[model samples]
Target: MFIIELTYKVPATEIDAAMAGHVAFLEKYYHSGHFLASGRKEPRDGGLIFARATSKGEIEKIISQDPFSINGLASYRIIEFKATKKIKAFDDFAGDEI
Candidate 1:
């Protein structure tokens, strides 16, 4: 399993449109069993998403469809890593416990 952290630099003009699609994406991923948790950062700096996927490619596909990427509302950085272990709260999430 892998964890993907996405940070966006949103432009002022596209904020509402971007957020609408962003929330829609979150709901889609959650129902599809890919998204674990997602939300905007405090002070609205950007957003954070925790997802479980088999490969970086899979995660990339997900991000590529985001409103931030689609409408050019923001940009993102993806960090890929193998999860060695999980403690307490994270471990309690049933889908990707590795």
Candidate 2:
């Protein structure tokens, strides 16, 4: 699994302008099984994406295509982790490793 953190580089206005396209990008990945969950941050400065990928390189390739990144609206920080534990109700989120 990977946690993708996006920190806005441009103004909120610019971010909003790109919101539709950004969401479309996310939707495509969701259908392809690349992204699991995503949402805006507490302060609304940026956003976060929870995803499952075969490797860091694969994740990098997908993220590079996000509208936010392509438009220079935000910067991405990708973190990969193992799910050693999780609630049974959400076990599926941890993928087959659990």
Candidate 3:
């Protein structure tokens, strides 16, 4: 699992302008099962995403497709982790170990 944090690099207006494309990018990943959950951060400075992937490189490739990334509107911080415990609802997405 990975925690993908997006921090705005440009102004909010710039991020807003790319919202539609950004959403489309998110939808694509979500539909493909790479993304589990995502939403804006409090104070609206950036966003957060929970995703599943085999490697950080895979996540980086996915991130490269984001409009925010394409337009250089945001910076990404990808944190990889091993899930020791999770709800039953997340079983499928949580990988085999936990």
Best by TM-score: 3
TM-score for each predicted model, relative to the true structure: 0.74, 0.90, 0.93
| Model 1 C-alpha lDDT per residue in residues 1-98, reported as the tens digit of each score | 44555555565556765677778878988897777777677767677777777677888898898877787666666666655676776555545532
For candidate 2, what is the TM-score?
0.90
Q: Write the per-residue lDDT of candidate 2 for residues 26-93, one digit (tens) a residue.
A: 99989887787999998989889998888889889998898888988899999999877777755565
List pairs with backbone clashes in candidate 2: none
lDDT string for model 3 (16-44, tens) is 99999999999999998889899999889
TM-score of 1: 0.74
Candidate 2's error at 15, in angstroms?
Answer: 0.3
Best by lDDT: 3
RMSD of each: 3.0, 2.1, 2.1
Q: Which window of 10 residues has the lowest lDDT sum in candidate 3?
A: 89-98
**What is the TM-score ranking, best to worst?**
3, 2, 1
**Predicted candidate 2, C-alpha RMSD:** 2.1
